[model samples]
Target: MKMIGLVAIVASLINVSIPFQSRAETVLSARDLFDACTRADMDWISFCNGFIQASNDHAVRLGMACTPAGTTRTHLVEIFEYSAARLLVSQSELGDAAGLEVASAIIGAAFPCN
Candidate 1:
């Protein structure tokens, strides 16, 4: 019946890998991400959040951190910029690896599981 068809569609969508190009997949520098963040670039913020969400999702699965209820995403951008600035002192590219670094640092400071 209709329920069976709907269940099949949901099951099929579960493992589908949508096109999500993380910073590592691109060549933009960390400086740029930070710069965009300073200016509050909507596009950059959107992309940055998307990137962080993926990292956070994985970290949650590993029980690394627990996001406080009612926490706003604004913190994600703050953490991203903070981490990027710290890292950019040496390296340049703020690739997806930086996203992971950001997530780890933020988890400890902002959402410690303890």
Candidate 2:
């Protein structure tokens, strides 16, 4: 019985430590930022870099989503936005430009205006 209890406790701890997948993946590093923008196009490199350096401030002003654990919401939002953009970009040949445009629009749209 003691061993079973110990196993259960350990499992619970692991579950708690693992951030929920539903919460979205946070963008933290330059690569992550770049990847998000690049999904739209190679032309977005400069755009992505500029935004990455300015992202924190943007997140603050725009009220981006953040984890209760203190993970910046911008990171997760960026990831989600990037994913949507990439999907559209990848399908541009398939008449996905509108979808990509909408997804890409959301990236900066979430930022709060000061």
* Best-performing candidate as measured by TM-score: 1
lDDT of 1 by residue, 24-76 (tens): 35544335545666666678778777666665666576676687776566776
* 100: Cα error in model 2, Å: 15
CA shift at 51, candidate 1, in angstroms? 1.8
Candidate 1, residue 76: the lDDT equals 65
Regions of model 2 farther than 4 Å from truth: 1-36, 39-46, 67-81, 86-114
- lDDT of the structure predicted as candidate 1: 0.51
Error of 1 at 61 (Å): 1.7
The C-alpha stretches of model 1 lying farther than 4 A from their native spots are 1-40, 90-98
Q: What is the TM-score of each candidate against the true structure?
A: 0.52, 0.26
Which ten-residue region of model 2 has the weakest summed lDDT?
Answer: 94-103
Per-residue lDDT for 31-80 in model 2, tens only? 34435555656556556545643544444444542223453544534653
lDDT of each: 0.51, 0.39
